[model samples]
Each structure stands twice: as C-alpha cells, then as structure tokens.
Target: GESVGLHLPTLSVQEGDNSIINCAYSNSASDYFIWYKQESGKGPQFIIDIRSNMDKRQGQRVTVLLNKTVKHLSLQIAATQPGDSAVYFCAAEGNGGADGLTFGKGTHLIIQP
Candidate 1:
C-alpha cells in the first residue's frame, strides 16, 4: 500500500483490468477503516470497510487488505470497468478524540480506452 499524506494524492488506471489502489493509514491505533469511491459530481460512496483487528475483507469484486505492522491498507478492484472509474480514497477513524474519519486524498482512477 502507498503512503497517504501531503505527498501522495492520486492514482490512475486502465479500463478492463484489475486495479489495486494503495493507501497508508495515519494511525495504527485507529480501530476502523473504510474505503469510498467518489464519482464526478457525486458524493463519496462506501466501498468496503475493515477493522484494525482484521487482516483482510472481501466484497463483490473488491477486497480490502490491512497490515497493522506497516500501517498500510489496499483496495483491490477486480475487472475494473469504466463505471469503476472514480476517485478512490481511504478513511481511518480518529484514535480517540473524534468519531470522524480522516480521509486520504482522492485517487482519480481514469478509464483509459
């Protein structure tokens, strides 16, 4: 999984292929994590989620893997299509203070023909 911060902000992918969007979480102490996909002009849509206790989670053509050691996470999209083209990002719940999630930058997934 790629690190998320002021440094990494986006990712691009081709159509009809598998896309792996990497993400580095900020807090190892965070309990929950979520992935969202935001299409053009639309709100962020929930993709999948995982707990810090879990190593991996799978969904319909999607998978979320978590590594607590390096504090990394990745989203795997199978047979990514044009409809899958969007900004993908991850969110981690604050350690204790707030109940809100700290979101990573939007990774704009372009469907290259």
Candidate 2:
C-alpha cells in the first residue's frame, strides 16, 4: 500500500559543493529515523538517525533535520564531492517497526568536476 521512492532521480554538483537530499515518508506514526547512503553496488551505509522525540541530529560532515508537523524530512550534506555522489534514502520506523518502513522513490546524487 505504501512505498518509498526517490524524489530526484539524479543530482550533479562540483567536488567542493554542498548537497541536499530530500525524502518523503507515508506513515506518520513512525518513531525512529535513519539516513542511508548507497554507493553504486554497495549496501546502504548508515549516515545519521533521529527519533520522533527529537527534531534534529548531527554527525560527522552530515546533519539531519526532521519535521514531524508536516511529515517531511531532509538531509543536508556539507562540502559535497565525488565520493558523496550516491543515492540517498530516508527510512522511518513505522509504529516502531510494527508496519515496517515506507521508503521514498529515491534520489540520485551526482558530483561534477
């Protein structure tokens, strides 16, 4: 019934530029939040995560901001580069993993020289 897909299929930027990845979730009752980065054929790597009780979380060279009021989520990347070019996805734990996560379509991030 619910599915997660990418918002922007592709994104391009310079080696020293910044990137912003966006994701939209269907389930509003989710509690846990996680941001993953998939590079090519590799598995998704955990970037950052936050709970419903908190609104923002930060990590090394990454920051995640959650807005439960609108059910919208966004990931901000500082100093984007070729290595940062990958598919970014946001997943939410529906009802504490009861219903699972409904991932977004997905967004392809591309880096330029």
- TM-score of each candidate? 0.87, 0.88
Residue 88 in candidate 2, Cα distance off native in Å: 1.0
Residue-by-residue lDDT tens digits, candidate 2, 1-113: 44454567777878787787877666677778888888888998888998989888888888888888877788988988778888888887865577776666567888888
| Steric clash pairs (candidate 2) | 4-103, 4-104, 4-105, 5-104, 5-105, 5-106, 6-105, 6-106, 11-110
Instruction: Give the residue spans of candidate 1 off by over 4 A.
Output: 1-8
Per-residue lDDT of 25 in model 2: 69
**In candidate 1, what residue range of length 10 has the lowest lDDT sum?**
1-10
Q: State model 1's lDDT.
A: 0.80
Per-residue alpha-carbon lDDT of candidate 1 for residues 1-113, written as tens digits (9 for 90 to 100): 22344234565667778888888866667778889999889999999999888999999999999998988888999988878988888888854536577888867777777
